[model samples]
Target: MRKYWFKVEGLMFKERPFCYLKFRHFIMIVVLGCFLLTNGELSSVIEIEARIPQKNDLFSNGKMDSYDSLENRKLLLFIIDFNDFMCLSCLDSFLDFYYCLPSDFQKHLSWGILVFNISEKEGNNNISARIVEKKLRGFVAANNIKFPILIDKFHVFNGLAEEGTVVMVFDWNRKMVKRYVFPLNKGQIEEIFKFLTE
Candidate 1:
C-alpha cells in the first residue's frame, strides 16, 4: 500500500491507495439508499388495497347482501365514517359526480357506500344496531341515495386501509386499482371515469 500525503489549510492527511474508490463507493451507497427510501414511500402510497369483507352480514337497504354481488363489474366504493362532517361532505360531492354522469357511462359502474366506525364501541358512544339503522335510513332517504348503503356492523372492512373517508376503485376482477382519500378532484374523477369506461 502507498501513502499519499495531502495538505489542506496547513493540516496534513494521508490517503490510502484506494481512497478515491472508497469515496466513490460511499457516494454510490448514499445514492442507492436514497433511491430505496423514495421507492418504498411511493409504493406505500400507490399500492394501498382494500380488504373486502366476505361475510353475509353486510346489510344494504334493509336486506342482507354479500360482497359477491359486487363481483364481475367495475365497482366504486366509498368507505366512510358517517359521523365525520368531512366524510359526509365528501360523500355529497361524490354523489353529485355520480348523478351527473351520462346514462351510458353510469351503467358501466356499480357504486356502494360502506358505513364503518359507528357500531364499534368508542369511549361513551356504544351505538346499537337499531339506532345505526335508523340514522342510516334517514340519511339515505334525505339524500335519495339509490345505490346500496352497506352497514358494516362487524367492523369487517375497518383497519384494512387508513381510517376516515376513502374511495376505492375495483376492476371486474375485484382488484383494487386505485384509491383516493377524501374528496374527489376533477383529475381523479376523470381517471376513475376512464378506468370504468375501459
Candidate 2:
C-alpha cells in the first residue's frame, strides 16, 4: 500500500489510503441522500393544485379573475376563516411579514388573503353570505390591505387545510410548494424569504 501526503503552508499532513477515502465518501453520500429525502418529506405539508375561482362574486373588489392572470409570479395565498379569532391574529402576523418584505421582492410576489366565514349553528341563526362579505370588506378596509381580498362565499378554500388559518406558497408554475398553519415562526419565515428571493 502506498501513502499520500499533503502540504498546507509549513505543515505536512498524511492523507488516508484511497480505499478508505472512497469508503468515507460513500458513507457521506448515503447520509446526505437520506437527509435530503427526509427533509423534503417534512417540508411539504400538503401538495395541491389550487385553482382560483373566476367569478366576480368571489373577489372583494368585484373583479373577475383567474389563476392564469397571476402568471410569472409566485403566489402566496393566506386562507383564513374570518370567524376565528386565532386566525385573525395570525393574519396580523402574516401582514407584518408581508410589510417587512423589500419592495422588489413584493413586486415579484402575487399574494392575497382568501377570507371565508364558516357558519356555526348558534341557536336558530346562521350567518348569511351577504353579511359575511360585508364584514370581510370592513376588515380589509380597516387593515388597509391593498392585496386582493378573495371572498370565498361557498367555502371553496375551507377544505384546503385542517387549520383555520393556513399559508400556502405556490411556485410560478402554480404548484403548491409549502403549507404552514397558524403564525409562522422565525425559521419558517426565513425559509419563505429565501424562496421569494430565489
Candidate 3:
C-alpha cells in the first residue's frame, strides 16, 4: 500500500507540470498574435480605416498607396474620405481637425489629410488622379488648410470603397485605434490630437 501511494503521487507531479507548461504556451501564442495585429488596420461591423499612411510611405513624393499604409502601432489613422470636397459640413470638419493638430507632429510620424477620389469614368484614366490632385489643391488653397492633402486613388488600381469621409487611426503596425461615424466635436478632436501627437 505504501509503494502504490508513492507511485501515484510521482505520476501526478509529472502530469501536472506538463499541463501547466502547455497552458502557458497556449497563452503566449494568443498574446503574440494580438501584439502582431496591433499595428495594422482592422475592420469592425461597419467601416474600414487606417492612419494617414505617411510614415510607411517613406518616399514622401505624394504618391497614393492604400496598401503601403502607415505602420503606427499606437497612432490612429484619420482617413477622411470626402466624396465631395465641396460639401460645406465636410470642409468644416476637415478644417476643424486640421487646425487642431499639433504643429510639431511631423517629427514623429507621417501625416496628411488624405483626399481620395472614387469616380465612374472607369478604365485606367489617370486623368481622375490628376483631377483629384488639382481639386484637392484647390480645396486646400480655398480653405487655407495648414495640413497637407494626399490623393489616395488606389481605388483605380484595386477598386472603390464606400462614399463619405472615413477617418481611421492605426498604431505602429497599422492596427486601428478608433473611428468616428459622426463628425467629431472640438473636444473629441482635441483629445485625439493630444494623444496622437504627444
Candidate 4:
C-alpha cells in the first residue's frame, strides 16, 4: 500500500499502486551494476593469448617462442603448481593423454605446460631464481616432456589457482572453448579429444 516516486529530469513520476517501486529500483541497480562490470555485455566464452617470454625456455637453448605465429593451431594449455608435491598426478595425466593421441590429431593441436611456484619458499628450500630455474629444467629433462615447459613468469593465471592444476582449451581463433580443473581423468581426456575433432 506504499506509494513510491522517482525524479527524472526535474520531473517526479509516481509508481503504480500495485508495484513495489523501491524493490524495482534496487533490482534495476543490481542489473545495471552487473552490466557495467562486464563492460555492458557478457559472454560464455573468453579469448586468452598468453605472453611467452623470449628467453624463458628451459630447453631449446633458453629461447621461448610465441604461439601467436601459428594462426590455425588449437592450444591445450596445462597449468600446474610446481610447489605442490601431490600435483604430479596432473603431469602424469598430461603425458598419458599426449602419447595416446593420434598423429593426425597431434598435428592439428599444440600442447604446453606452464608450471608456477607461487610460494616464496619452494619445497623446503629458500632458493634463488637461478637455482629454481635449474630445478625446473631438470624436471623437464627427467620427464622427457616433448612439449614446451615454461615457468609462469607473469602470473597470468594466478586467479585460476595458486595451488592446483588447471587445463584450458583454446581454439584456432584463440577463443577459449573449455577449462578443466585437476585431477583430470580419462573421461575428460576423451572429452577434449572429442572437442578437438569437432
Candidates sorted on TM-score, descending: 2, 1, 4, 3
Error of 4 at 58 (Å): 22
User: Which residue pairs collide, candidate 4?
Assistant: none
Residue range 1-198, candidate 1, lDDT tens digits: 123233441232134536666777999989988996765221111112233433432334545456686565566676656554334664676667767665533332334444545433453333554555666676666765555556565565666435556767778564667787666788988887787766
The predicted structure with the larger lDDT, 1 or 2, is: 2
lDDT of 4 by residue, 1-198 (tens): 123233431233233433456667889999988986867532111112233433322223334345555445456676656654345665676556666766533322444444444455444322433454566566656764445444545555556655476767777554557888766677898888776666
Task: Show model 4 residue runs off by greater than 4 Å.
Answer: 1-72, 85-90, 103-108, 111-113, 118-128, 173-176
Q: Which ten residues in a row have the lowest lDDT in candidate 3?
A: 40-49
Ranking by lDDT: 2, 1, 4, 3
Q: Pick the candidate with the highest lDDT.
A: 2
Better of 1 and 2 by TM-score: 2
Clashes of each: 0, 0, 26, 0
Question: Top model by TM-score, which number?
Answer: 2
lDDT scores for all predictions? 0.56, 0.57, 0.52, 0.55
Question: lDDT value for candidate 1?
Answer: 0.56
**Candidate 4 lDDT for residue 164:** 70
Clashes of 2: 0
Q: Candidate 2's residue-wise lDDT over 1-198, tens digit each?
A: 123232441132124466566777999989988996766221211112234443322233435357666454565677766655334665677667767776633332444445554446532223455565566667666765545555565455668745756777776554547887767789989888776667
